[model samples]
Target: MPYLGLIVLVVMIAALIDIVSSDDALVRGLPRWAWLLLVIVLPLVGSVVWFVAGRPVAGFSGRVGRDRPGQASAMGFPEYDHPGRFVPQDPEADAAFLKQVRERAEAQRRQGEIERRRRVERERGQ
Candidate 1:
């Protein structure tokens, strides 16, 4: 019976790892409660199910960039069918993105103003 417990433990561990590492689509397709039940009730079967269907890619082995750790794939591909790259829901991050956009717009405005002044001065000199 001890061997059974060991197998269960390993299967549970595998299921947990598979769930955490996988993308949202995989998780959404199979509910968390279902996963919990699968892992708890039938260890080996659950682990096998998670391995086959829970993982993002079956045969994919390549990792993302060298600098970034735990990234999904190279060039940072989005796992889900979302329009944009997945960003964590953080107000501060949204504010920062807005600030960056505002700053770029301001820079462009300033450059336009400078060009206008230069043109005016040139006309006045002529």
Candidate 2:
């Protein structure tokens, strides 16, 4: 019974760390909720799934099951070189890109308007 408790404790700790530290957007398209469910509802399966499908370290090489290179390895936590890498992309980039597209569209609209005016003038012969 004591051994079983220890095992459960270890799994809970691993699951919490994995969920908290994971970048759901960066790696697989799965959500954190799914991971939480897996860990909470099913311990053994959840731990395996977490280890297999979790994010990969930026510069780590070889099999993921292996120990981390330099950083502390705790229940296969992926060591991100920069966690900010997973941060949602800058809204500024989206804004600037949209701005460029809008500008191009506006220029095209103005050119079309000028052409229409020229055509109308020619038709009126004035």
Displacement of the residue 13 alpha carbon in candidate 1, Å:
1.4
Summarize candidate 2's per-residue lDDT along 21-120 as a digit string, tens digits. 7655444436787777777888777767776775444554332222344542222223323333232255466456556776898999999999999999
Model 2 clash pairs are: none
TM-score of each: 0.39, 0.45
Tens digit per residue, CA lDDT, model 1, 12-87: 8978777766555435447766776776687888877877766555544332222334544213333322423344
Off by over 4 Å in 1: 27-29, 58-126
Worst 10 residues of 1 by lDDT: 74-83
- Whole-model lDDT, model 2: 0.62
Which structure among the candidates has the greatest lDDT?
Answer: 1
Candidate achieving the largest TM-score: 2
What's the lDDT for all of these models?
0.63, 0.62
TM-score of 1: 0.39
